[model samples]
Target: MTLYYDETGDTKLPFESLSIAETVIQGTLRYLESPYDAEVNLLLTMNNEIREINQEHRNIDKATDVLSFPAIDFEVPGDFSDVSTFDLNPETKELILGDIVISKEKVLSQGDEYGHSPLREYAFLIVHSVLHLVGYDHMEEDEKETMERIQKAIMEYLKISR
Candidate 1:
């Protein structure tokens, strides 16, 4: 898995030594057993910027912890059987999973509020967003249960706990 990472925010991350965000992302892909080599784009931004993006895209008018824009619409979550040739990157032949935007401010605040390290919160968010990229969603109760279960498993796999 390849991660294209970027950061755009005045608020720096609370934790200084957590490059494990990349590990969390790759771990998610492995946990799902993605059929093809995959790449993801990640952005670390501030709350206000994410809020504006959320408002523009989702029209929710609120700051979110993370947002995912998936490149493929799977017939079933994590089922890559139907992937097409078009989904692959021409140069690298890797599946373009999609993009993730995270709120750095939320990573700090939520970690403190939830009584966990920022690293843990950051890892959780990365896993959550990667699941979204693979077509997992929580719009319904059953789906929520499944997604949550998978998330827990991946977190355990990565040895990251709250």
Candidate 2:
């Protein structure tokens, strides 16, 4: 798993704390623990750029915190009993996960609203986006709860307490 990340836009926003372009390529590879190669690319941009991206991809003009573009269309099993088990991609020996786009401006603003550090909020967004790349959705109440639980667990594991 290779996470390729890049960032664009102002680095000096009043509300912005940490504007970074981080790629968790090696960490993602280790987490997946599969012979398959999963590449996860992310572009963290400001609100204006994000708005353009959202319009181009999702046909929505509004800026969203995060957006995921998955390579595969398989649905994860409803049972969360085996969430630790990583999926494998047999063909290319790589899962070829997908891409994530986040808005730094959104993160900072949301952090203030949620009463948490910008780092914690950013971490949450990363975890949330990664989970989506791995086929997690929260359209339903139960699914939302499950996803939130998983996100919190990952955050705790990373020692990112709010």
lDDT by residue (tens digit), candidate 1, 1-162:
677888896888856423676678777887888778888888899989999999999999999999999999887889888889999998888999899999999999999999999898999998998888888999999999999999999999999898
Tens-digit per-residue lDDT, 8-111, candidate 2: 88753343332322333333334434344566677878998889989999899998998988666545522222332244345445556678888888888998
Clashing pairs in 1: none
User: TM-score of each candidate?
Assistant: 0.94, 0.75
Cα lDDT, all candidates? 0.87, 0.67
> Residue 139 in candidate 1 has what lDDT?
96
Which is the leading candidate under lDDT?
1
Best by TM-score: 1
lDDT of 2 at 46: 90
Output the lDDT of residue 34, model 1: 78
Separate clash counts for every candidate: 0, 5
